[model samples]
Target chain A: MEEIKDTFLHPVVPLDFQNNYRVGAYLQRYLDGFKEKKILGAKCSQCGRVVVPPRKYCGACNLVMEEFTELPQEGTLENFTVGHVNLEKGQWKRADAPYVIGMVRLDGAANAMLARLNVSPADARAGMKVKAVWKDQVEGEHADLDCFEPA
Target chain B: MRNVGIIGIGYTPVFVSKRKDVSIVEMISEAVDAGLKNTGLAPEDIDAYVFGNMATFEGVNMPHLWATEHMHARGKPIMRFATGGTIGMAAFHGAYYHVASGMADIAMAVTYEKHSEGDAQVGLMGIITPELMAMLSAGIDVTGQSGMGAIGGGSAGGISFQASSYLHRSGAGIEHIDAIAAMERRNAAKNPYAHLKDPEATAEKIAQTPMVSWPIRFGHICPTTDGATVCILASEEKAAKIADKVAWVLGVANCASDATTANLIDSQITDPAEQLPAIMASKKACERAGIEDPKKEIDYVEIYNGFAHQTLMYLEKVGMCEVGEAHKLLEAGELEMNGRCPVNASGGVVSTNSIGTSALNRVTECALQIMGQAGEHQVEKEVHKAMAHGWGGLMQYCTITILGDKPKKL
Candidate 1:
């Protein structure tokens, strides 16, 4: 066997890809409500449950959720986490500051929505009252519903 | 449907972080050769092939198309599945269905993962990429306050919430999590194929590890391993003719729930710790298998526990024990290799996680125990029946398979 050198001959190939995803009719309408500073939930006629970030189907009832309803701004924090690190793509790095992320059950909606909380990590508790804060300048996109703050 | 049995199982020579000497196809061929060697069967005997792996983990798409010759699957009907960590079991069940449905006399389920070849985290994030893109299009930065932007908590962060909830509801402490991790690591030490072996692992040692999240330590996580696992399934007649000892498949079932809580992004009104899908899938499988009481019938178990806490959590969810009783069982030494009901005698996914093989390993491990061919790691008890579990697909999907020493009574 011969000793092989020039191990540096390994080549680097960078593959870049961009894709366009259809927001679909359900989410498209939900985002449209953001323009009017309103949050929407789809109601399932069979189960009578309201799902936020509106979708076309209710998994529990297996019914078409075509009935759109407006949800209240206030909610109860169902669950949360205090992140000490940040996950980027596939790498983990220490965060400059720990932040609180909460799962909130908005009023009048049967399902919960996830959003960052504007509170200290120590103060973040499950079942705490919170209200949504918007970006002021609505762009008809997801960011329009900014982080939730303690109510 | 016809009766199906596992006739043979094969694993790579080693489960490690890397296989630098061989290419992806070359590494998988090792297991194929081992399977053929074990059952004295040839490539021609296998009528079909069912392959699975976490796609994009190795930077390759539809790898079976490129490695047909290496897998000895040339001119054979091939099917593939990709269900996150449960792909292995999913593919195994695919082969089981093929043989059970009388489509083929014999079929092979091959599953593997070479995490060393690509970035695992990136591959994991790919599951929520579309969600991330939607978040990005909304002008929300990818690494903003919601962690990895919207729905970027990754596996560990979300699992922490699960672990915390389990601790709260079960009245188990973080110490129990440490104990479970330590126990599985110690179990891994006895298995040759396991990747992370720690015979002397203790709760104190596990607790010493850095805390990644509340109630979860670094030691509680599964390692990314490079390895392959293959199992050969056959019809009852074929199994009896080809192999002397067979692990009969009494039942097989899989169920999936909402991917919200599993993704750690926007959780619906569901609780991650509830794990309703696991309860439903296991119950449905037990019913199909005619098991009147799983707690009394199952002699051994192999749970797809990527994290140590899941071993305890799933044990209860699968009806192996009453709710909030798995930890108590653990503290009583009932989950050890020589316990009343031994669990993860082959360590578990917590010990050797080749993401694709993790789920399938549970079934194969249980089969080995039922066949009495597990060698040193075999449970001391006379194993009559065992249950193998696989949990994946954003943690909402579950696959349950029941294996028994005797064939199912038709």
Candidate 2:
């Protein structure tokens, strides 16, 4: 058979994929509370696992979490990676070539947070401490806090 | 173990990077032809088909539709398999079982990815629960995701943190990762089919390359690729007739995690959890084929090392190491093509990363070594036994296969 095109033609159709992410109405109520400086978490009925960024169910116990309460906005950093690169078009593009990406442990909860911190690549080591920044309640949305940086 | 030999194998010239030269259909055709020619057989001779495609790579609602028509065995049974990076091998696992279970006399497995055509990032965008995204910021990007892991993993004054404890606990160092890149670079140089197989590959170059993730430099992580790979399976009875030498499929397995990226840490204490499926299918195959000592019995490997560090991880997860020693073995040069048990003599995915078809390519490479058809990349000593592995879906899904010379009488 005749060969049509070589394998080195297109590496990737480069594009920027970004969008405004949304949250549930019930969850928005917690975000509204966070704007008022209240940390909200979900309490599991079947298992005693408390969930921050409050969820509706306890993943481990396979039970619903209806009891919602304010929680401590504090948690430790878990396993993380400093990404010096950008995740776009399925390829890594270096911004400054080194940045921190990690999972934050929200206080009084089993599951940790997944996000990037505003710390320099050199200072974003694991087990470091971080605090949540909240947006003003009436004029804010969930992202009003931006992202957690070195606190 | 009942001997399960590869009767056919095929693949497109390794596409170096994303290319628009061929559509997914044409890519599959090239691979299917290579497979048919290698077996000295025709596509019509196959009885069934299995295909693997990571839809993320193609941006297609359903990828692998190309296989429905392009990869022969028309109208016969066909199964499509997927698991992020390991999709290719997952399909191979299905094909192996089709023949092993007596479902078909001869079976074919095909896999490919048109990296040039899709938006992998868009697919990854779905990682956070839709609810979580609404709760987070508007400008949040993928980099932010890894940053979250770091923040949760530990603390530092400024350095981007890694899974500090787990990484340190693994006893693996930068040298091990560097060595892996260097080896693949050298290996890719030997492979004309590889994308970045520049002749002057070196450890320094890989280390000096831009860092994508801390310790994960450009060379250390595989490039997104477009290409295709295929394998043909047959009863030992049919294979012996044409394959002057055969690479038997000893066993195959695939396992998946919940539909969330939440398992990236805590649950991944062992990660690659490749052993769960590998051990299950291996035991079943060994029981049917009667394999006693896999390490002592198997001779080589063509593991799917999409990221160079994974090579060490799999050797250990496959039950070949005591936890962290795979890195030691890796640093000691024990996993090289000339080492005690050569892995990925063809330089593997590290040298040439083929998105969808990498696993099948791994299986085919093993088959080639057994048949002594592997060219400059061939192993030094005769290889009677080999193993192949693959993973994807952000390292959540896994697939593994064992290849041997003959079906052991159970």
The 10-residue segment of model 2 chain A with minimum total lDDT is A6-15
Clashing pairs in 1: none
Best by lDDT: 1
Q: TM-score of predicted model 2?
A: 0.64
lDDT of 1 at B302: 97
lDDT of 1 at B222: 95
For candidate 2, the TM-score of chain A alone versus the native chain A is 0.69
Docking class of 1: incorrect
TM-score versus the correct structure, for each prediction: 0.71, 0.64
lDDT for residue A132 in candidate 2, whole number 0-100: 72
lDDT of 2 by residue, B318-384 (tens): 6555578777777677777777767777777877766678877888888787777788888787888
* Full-model lDDT for every candidate: 0.84, 0.65
**Candidate 1 segments exceeding 4 Å error:** A1-151, B130-143, B149-153, B262-268
